[model samples]
Target: MQGSNWPIEPIPNEHDVYFRVHKNYIVNDGPYMFKPRAFVERGDKADQHKSMSTNWEEYSTPEQTQSEAKIPMDNGVVAMSVGGLRSENLTVNHAPIPTIRAHTDVNGLPDDIKDVEVRVKLFKHCRWVINPELSTNP
Candidate 1:
């Protein structure tokens, strides 16, 4: 309910892209090889670094999200198009931080079956933006 109070903003263009960071463990074989769980947020684990939130590419660049946002350098970034997600019935809203929320609801909660389907679509559509294994910083 944190974003519920925030003013609703314009959604990113369909052609626009967003970024998601994945830890080393999320990588199956290489940086390009990603696990579906990477796109799914688990309620059991807290995102202490993100303040229990996820940031989209519209608000920040992949490098900034990792460096400026204080995410670990060892993590890799995956890029997905706004249109692709929308096609899957997922909503991309820019509520100050630019978040990916469920199309049916506004809170962006990720515990339901719809969220699971969305995660799978994200996994299928995403491509490597920054390969952790090839990154000089990593």
Candidate 2:
């Protein structure tokens, strides 16, 4: 919300990349769209939207497409969509094939927003932080 203490969304993912990493998975580039400022429409009454989504379409519609889609998501996931890509043809340079998965116990999120409950790409940055940890043998 406008008054929440949440810092801010990193930035909306570019819609044309065709492929980009999120939680270590090289997902379809077109579907990696991101939003910075989202607001749920007044009409939206779905429990899912009230809990996670904040976009107008998310709230104004009946039976959101998200419920029926096979898109993988987090407990509070609010962004990105998996529109089906040919895994055999897509390749990610550093990411392991198959899928890159993560389990979050609110590990790297702002504590204030954690209780508020919003889906985000926090896994995106977690991966970035891992390079240093892995690169240094220590």
Q: Residue 61 error for model 2, in Å?
A: 23
After superposition, which runs of candidate 1 have C-alpha atoms over 4 Å from their true positions? 1-8, 15-17, 28-32, 42-58, 68-71, 97-110, 113-116, 135-138
* Per-model TM-score versus the true fold: 0.59, 0.16
Reference-based lDDT, each prediction: 0.50, 0.22
Backbone clash numbers for all candidates listed: 0, 6
lDDT of 1 at 90: 62
lDDT of 2 at 56: 20
Tell me, what's the RMSD of every candidate? 6.9, 18.6
* Cα error of candidate 1 at position 111, Å: 2.9
Which whole-number lDDT from 0 to 100 does residue 31 have in model 2? 39
Once fitted onto the true fold, the runs of candidate 2 whose alpha carbons sit more than 4 angstroms away are 1-32, 37-65, 68-104, 114-138
- Summing lDDT over every window of 10 consecutive residues in candidate 2, give the lowest-scoring window: 96-105
